[model samples]
Target: MLLTERLMAGERVFSAWSSVPDSLNAEGLAATPFDAVCLDMQHGAHHEDSVMRCLGPIIASGKPGLVRVPVDRFDMAARALDFGAQAVIAPMVNSVADARAFAQSMKYPPVGKRSWGPHLAMGRSGFSGPQSAWLDEANRKTLAFAMIETREALDAVDEILAVAGIDGVFVGPSDFSIALTDGKAVDPSLESMMEAIAHISARAQAVGKHAGIYVVDPKLVQRYSAMGYRLFALGNEQNYMERGAAALLADAGALTS
Candidate 1:
């Protein structure tokens, strides 16, 4: 099912968003936990080949997956979707036009003019099966998440939300912090940013759309949930892995009495 479908049903989706460029670990991680995986093709070491490699495992894992491409480029968007990603989360979506284009590039034919072909939507071209038809339904099934990452995006969140056909908005706090600080860390400025995000959530709820967010501080997850955040990318794979390993080692050292 498309992410939008699940979100519309009022399911609080938990996704793992990451910048791990290695396909092996990415696929393994996707298969392990998470309702979906948003491969970090943006600001990560992943190239087109890497994206393909990472996605290969995700498809085989029986998990729904999405990718965050570097920019709003249609080719990148089209390819990411072609690779069987249930969705594509675009970065720096700050306007209604950008959101429209993001949605336009994601669909096919009347939905969007994406060059049609069977690459990974099915195992092969001209290969039609009940499951294969599932891929064809992608035009209707695929999702498009426009990231709310900048101050500009916050300002236009309501207008952007008014755009029809957009599945949801993903909040990128790091970049959002940058936008708030003009390039600094998240702090007091975050209060207003949080308010802006909350406002977006309310608007989404009003219009029956979805609102996704990245949760860095685990403490904030439930708080945001109370404010109506539906899709939560709890944290990147690297964040948890690093913290877990470090904590284990620290505990081991402390036991050396």
Candidate 2:
């Protein structure tokens, strides 16, 4: 099922964010039980060419692929979609205009201005149906997530969520915490930031739109889930690799006993 379908069906989504920019890693992660594979194009090591390469493996793995496109770059979002990304999570969408632009880039005509050119995406995504059928389904199947990171976005959450064609509001908690405190590193302990997160989730839920968030630990997932966040981007492979290697080393040390 498409990521949008899962979200609409009220299923909790667990996604892995691939900041490593390696196709092999992307493929491996996508093959897991995670609902989606999100390639990071904003802060991660992926450029256009790399993301294109990563898409092939992700598609072959049969998991929905998402790209966290560079901030407000509608063209980049369009490219990601055209390259087989089932969804595009646009970072730092601070206003309704930002949400509209992001939505327009993801949807086709009559809904938005995204041009028809799923060159590699058509085959990569395994769409053997008629072109018209694909077009008809694309808009609804394609998810657009607006990242609410800054203080401005938190204040305008209602308007952003109200924008037509916006699938969800993705909370960048780290940046949100920083924005709340004016240039400090993300400190989740702050009561104000916690309140902002609650308000953001509440606003999205109020409108029947999904609320998503980034989490480094599994324990936090339950906490955010209780607050109505259904979509989660767990930590990337780099962190996983480190943790895995540490566990293996500890096991080796204990094996001598």
Candidate 3:
């Protein structure tokens, strides 16, 4: 099923994404956690080959597999789908035009301009013949998510959500912190920022679309979820590993002593 469907079904998704270069670790990490795991090709060192490997366990886990392409390029998005990525989170989409281009690239001609072929998605080397009929279904099944990071995007939240094929909007406040936060933990600016995010999220809900956020700490993560964030990217991959490893060691040491 599409990740959006899972989210709309009221699934509180926990996506364990891989930040390191190794796809095996990415795949392994996804197999053990939440509903789905994203192989982060945008910020991580995970190349095409490694990413394919990382997807192994995620798909094996019976959970959906997601790929966060590093940039806003159609080629990257297209490549991700070719590798059997069930969905893609395109980083830094700031406008309605940008969203439309992404949708076109993601879908077939009628719905999108994505070139027809079953690269790795269907175990085919490539397009050996014309496949006009199947492209729409293929495009319809895959998901597209836009990152809401820029102040400009904040103003265009409603329009972005209104884009026909866009599945979800993820608030990336760490990168666009000012618009989403006034100061630090208790900054007054946070109230307005929070309100804005809540507004966008609410608008999304009103339209039957998903609202989401990428938060660093556990408290904030849960906080946003409680406020109705259905699809949340918990945090960066490195932080997850470091804290987990340290906690494991500390626990082991305490147990031994």
Question: Which structure among the candidates has the greatest lDDT?
Answer: 2
Residue by residue across 1-257, what tens digits does model 2's lDDT show? 88888888888999988988778888889787888889998999877887899989988887888999887678999999889999899999999999998888889988899999986899998778889998998898888999999989988989998888898899888788889879967764455677778888989989998899998667778878888999999888878888788889888895343
Q: What would the per-residue lDDT of candidate 1 be over residues 1-257, giving only the tens digit for each residue?
A: 55767877777788887687888877677776688777887876667877777877777776777888887675788888777677778898988899888877777666666677646756622336675565467666777778988878888887887765577788887788777778767652377577777887888788766778878787887878888998887677678788878889888885343
Please provide, for model 3 over 77-123, each residue's C-alpha lDDT reduced to its tens digit, 9 standing for 90 to 100: 77777777778888788899989988777776666777765556665
Let me know the TM-score candidate 3 reaches against the reference structure: 0.84
For residue 39, model 2's alpha carbon misses the true position, in angstroms, by 0.5
Best by TM-score: 2
- Local accuracy by lDDT, each model: 0.76, 0.86, 0.72
Q: What lDDT is reached at residue 167 by model 3?
A: 77
Which residue pairs in candidate 3 collide?
Answer: 23-54, 42-70, 108-112, 182-189, 182-190
Sort by TM-score, top down from the best: 2, 1, 3
Instruction: Please state every model's RMSD to the true fold in angstroms.
Output: 3.1, 2.0, 3.9
Give per-residue lDDT, candidate 1, residue 177.
77
Q: Please give the range of 10 consecutive residues that has the lowest summed lDDT in model 2.
A: 184-193
lDDT of 1 at 176: 82
On lDDT, the stronger of 1 and 2 is 2
